[model samples]
Target: MRKRPAEPPVRREPEAPEGCLTVAIRIPVRIVVLVLVVPVRMLWDALVVAGRFLNDALLRPLGRALLWLGRAVFVWPFVALWRWVVVPVGKALGWLGHVLVVVPLVWLYRYVLTPVGHAIAWVARGAGAALGWIAGGVGAALGWVYAALLTPVGYAVMWVLKGLGAVLAALGIGVWTALAWLVKYLVVVPAVWLYTWVLAPVGRAIGWCAKGLVWLVSMAVTGIGTALYWIARILLVLPALAVWRWILTPVGRVLAVIGRELWDALGHAWRVAGHISLAVGRFLGTLFRWIFVEPVRWVYRSVLTPVGHVVRDAVWRPAAEAARSVGRATRQALAAARESVRQARADFRRMLFGEPRRPQPVDRREPSGRETRTLGSSTTALTKD
Candidate 1:
């Protein structure tokens, strides 16, 4: 046998320490809560009882009647229309659509469109094959022309162009050197002088002015922001923090305690009231039973029961038998009269119109009663011989 593992120790919760303030608040709060809650709880109980009585005696039956009336007025008519009118009309429309539209469309697709499509597909295949052969022949001819005639002409043109290019290169180099010398003296030298002496000084002055203006603007904005921060802190934040810390926190705690006590008192009062109401109801029920119910029950058992039995045996049974016999006689007489009337009608019809024709059987696919299949001679196709 193995040793059992050690059991875990149970942890106990620490109790809350109550102060003078909590103690002072609790007693008066509880007393006040109980006083306020008792009457409210009683009134609530009374309302619940009244509501239950009203629901049972009036509201439930009225709701059932209204429900029946609503079904009769609204739901039943719609149901009848759907069943008798709408369903039949919808079915007839569906059948007509199937016969008039769907059947013809299906027949056209199957018999007319399918054969036309096959013919078009066959003609397209033949045309595509002919076009492919023509394209191949044209491509081969173009390739042969490029290789045999155009190649030699292209080579001769390349040689002539190369000779002209060499002559142009020599003339271009001399003209390019002359233009470079003129551009350096007339345009490049003047542009460097204007930038170095005039534009550099003016740009440095404008940059210094812009930096000073930016520094002044930044300093003004920083000062204004700092002043606003301090003003808001003193005017709004400090007072709001003080109110929250000193006033609202304490008041909320007091209110929370009072609310908790009141809720507990209400629950307690409700339970107590329930017991009081149950006891009172039982007492009243017992009083009523003794005063009225017992006397009525005794009278019903002692006087009414015997009298009812006497009336049933002496008067009710004999009258009931007599009424049944009379009803049977009356029914027999009516049935005989009905038979006579039916016979008279039959005779009158025979005198006026002669005998009605009896239908004669016609030949059909299946065998008749006299020609049914037998074991000796089979009607099945495989065994006909």
Candidate 2:
């Protein structure tokens, strides 16, 4: 209650220092801001408040508006400066959204979806292959059963056909054998007989006649040729021969006289030639018999001694045996014939008288057999009367 009590209570807020930046220093409202960076919004609201306050205090609205316009122009650089910060924040937000959405989706596909899908595909393929193999097996089995069922039927049919073929072959062979036998008896022999008896001899007679005619013609031609040759020789050479003979006739007579004179000389030469020829013939014969025949015998023995023994057992001995048998039989027969001839000579007179005891009167009769007929035979038989 003293007089000093009227002093004002001490202020609680700190006083803004001079010369430092302050809110109410009366700066243009456009230069002041509420947000730290967007000064334009705060300054615009502040300017509008200032204009209303001024319009209320004084009537200078136009001057106030001019001042506001001046302040706005001055504050434009600050508003423009905020774009760098805002644009960077917006771009950062957009990139964050892109990473959030795309990264998880790609990670899920790599870590989970791709392997799961491949495994599912592999399982599906394996199942499909299994089904295919089972179906193929069933189909193959069915085809095998079908083939196996038909095989026995085919074999049975083949067996029946084989049996039938064998039976038919046997029957055909039997029929052929019977036919061959019948033909041999009834046809072949008759045909051969007819040909041999009738046609063969006729053909042979015609052939012989033709041969004789040809031989006669050839002989006639040869005779004519010989005659012509003789005539030509006479024409060409007989005159020369006659001339030579006439010229040599005197020489020949002289030579005959010489021969008569030289008969002893020619006789001695002839005797010598004859004796030499006879001696040569005897010597050559002896040499040939001794040398060639003995050597040939030795060569034959050397080459064929074992061969002869082997062949004798194989072939030649049998042939020699047969020849020896024939010779022995012939010798025996000749000896018997000689004995019989001697006996017959000893009884010759008795046999002659004894044979007169009986006589066979000859009564020749004409042939009666049908085989004596003229033409067409199995040509078979000849009858002798």
In terms of TM-score, which candidate is strongest? 1
The C-alpha RMSD in Å for every predicted model, in order, reads 9.1, 92.7
What is the alpha-carbon RMSD of candidate 2 to the true structure? 92.7
lDDT of 1 at 303: 95
Which pairs of residues have clashing backbones in candidate 2? none
**C-alpha local distance difference test of each model:** 0.89, 0.75
Which ranges of candidate 1 are over 4 A from the true structure? Answer: 1-28, 155-255, 284-299, 322-385
**Best-performing candidate as measured by lDDT:** 1
Q: Model 2 — TM-score against the truth?
A: 0.24
lDDT of 2 by residue, 1-385 (tens): 6465577788799875643222233233222221222434334445766788888877586778878888788766556665777677888988997799888899999999999999999999999999999999999999898799978888999999999999999999999999999999999999999998999999999999999999999999999999999998989789888877887886786666545435533444445545655565578779998989888888789877868888889798889999999999999999999999988886997766664457776654443455475534323346343
- Report the C-alpha lDDT of model 1 over 159-275, residue by residue, as the tens digit: 999999988988899899999999999999999999899999999999999999999999999999999999999999999999999999999988887787667666776676667
